[model samples]
Target chain A: MSDDELARKQRRRRNIAIGLGVAGFVLIVYLVTILRMQANLAAGP
Target chain B: MRHKPGMRQPVAISSMSAPDVAGPQDYFDLLKPRVMSLVVFTAAVGMVAAVADGARVPFGLALASLFAIAVGAGASGALNMWWDADIDSVMARTVGRPVPRGVVPRAEAAAFGGFLSALSVALLALSSNYVAAALLAFTIFFYLVIYSMWLKRSTPQNIVIGGAAGALPPVVAWAAVTGTAPVEAWILFAIIFLWTPPHFWALALYRDGDYARAGVPMMPNVAGRAATKRQIFAYSVVLAVAGLAPYFVGMAGPFYLAVAAALGGVFVYLAFKTLRSGDEDKASAKQLFAFSIIHLFAIFAAVLIEDLVALHV
Candidate 1:
């Protein structure tokens, strides 16, 4: 691959990685909150 | 073409050097953390105020909810900055902001804000309820679309209307806690909403030239300073009454009433002083603007403390 093509591929990969990281972080937060709230509700007052 | 023996070959170099990678702090700055802190504080107060006597959530969950509130508020700020970056660049007071200073590109700001807006609201729903989640979404929309995109450049009533979006955080928190909004929740909303005009108009009074240059229809720029001051005085009277309403309605105690009365008087007095002054009294305008911030903080602090004490006793 040419240097330009390699650079473009690297940039695209970096963006996708960043996007996935953010998505994963948000997913974990939501899961933790859901589990915690469910446990609280199950504890019954 | 043959180069001379001493001449070096010209190398192909990329014209675009590396763009500065935004650090965590830059993203945080895009959130306008200062304003977010105040919103979070008020939202916490709203939560505390909404709780029935002796009712408590799991401490960890409560903390998570507060974090969500802060993130939602920050999302609104980021969206506001993204939309206002054009005007922000022109205004002297806002020229050094991340978006305007090129620390965060406008598209990046919008995308980050959009992502946070969804993430914060969705998390809030998981932690709280759909009512609160929906309110958060509406607040974001009001701020970004109604206020920033339309009313801001078009009308002198921009801040007056835009204030609703800023004021909704506390209401959203209250709804999150109670699962249903009460009249008291809206009373908190009213205090912030009513407080907005005088607070922002005081700023407009001093920053008239900046507003004029930026072509933003701030009250003092659209109307004369005299008219703006009259409106400020009018709003100050209404705000003082609204600020003290929680105590009158039995949400706060006598001590809060006294504190509110005293500070409210000082607030009105400052606005009055600014109004009565000649055209050149930027100091008086500045004083009113400074005191207005303190007035809100003091009133809300009293409410939070009074409610917490009430809960214990």
Candidate 2:
């Protein structure tokens, strides 16, 4: 592949990695929130 | 140069060039995964000890805090490698590191480290208390800026005080659970802090040429091997005392006390052996280096087991 092609490919991979990392972080936050709410509900005052 | 027997031979790299492609493993290596694992284990032990000491934190939150602490540790490692790439390139032991070997560019490594440092600290703050996050931030700054950038090149006592960065994980972990570090947490920090000199000085005694060639003023490189050996023995004695602090302070139980005493005795024995050996005895230093890792692991493992048993009772 051409140098420009390689650069574009690298950029695409970088964007994909960033997208996945952000998504994973969001998922962790969501899971933690749900788990915490579940615990509170189970406690039932 | 004639190295002592049983030393691992470093690959003779005559030339260095950038790879055509930087793979996932290269990036992962940038994190210094082995060092990260040790940090994670010690931080986890600290967190578990805090829980045993009556700090209430949700399991999920604790897990998240541990993750962030591990990342923060890795971030420091990456930043260290990035900043030390120049010297790392010259040192035989570090010549094959990702940046020095051109698997990862210095700029990319620095940016990666910077990004991870921010992300880890922010994640910690969101998951746990701001105190833990702030401590983690300080750890990254202290390791990268203070230790790696400044003291490493300037002082023979670089690892002496710079060890504070490594020793802070337990304190940060304790603060994550309690939102404040009690004396017990600081005791754990003290054990690791005192333990650091002997642990590293042993390695430095053997790798004296690397520090000299790289222009990094390690204790052995600056103060001579005999002085470094004496200092290592001195630190080991204090470390042995600090190792018993968990039991004396009532943070750890009798089970941990017994294990700590045994391991601390062995550590002192090894350090003494390193000190008493002839200048040519790289073997003693290597033994101390190897056993120092085992001592830390066993002490922390004992603490975790004791804490778990307490919870069961």
lDDT of 2 by residue, B1-313 (tens): 2222433333324353332455556677888899899999999999999999887888988998899999899989899988877777778888878887776778899999999999999888877879999999999999988898878778899999999999999999999888998899899899888888898898888888877777777898778888899899899988988899888878888888899899989999988888889867699999999999999999999999999999889
Tens digits of per-residue lDDT for model 1, B207-252: 8888776777888877889999999999998998898899777788
Query: What TM-score quantifies how close candidate 2 is to the native fold?
Result: 0.89
lDDT of 1 at B225: 90
The residue ranges of model 2 lying beyond 4 angstroms of the native Cα positions read A1-18, A35-45, B1-19
* Per-prediction CA RMSD (Å): 9.8, 5.4
TM-score of each: 0.86, 0.89
Q: What is the DockQ of each candidate?
A: 0.15, 0.24
The backbone clash count of each candidate, in order, is: 0, 0
Q: Among these predicted structures, which one has the highest DockQ?
A: 2
Cα TM-score of candidate 1:
0.86
- Model number with the top lDDT: 2
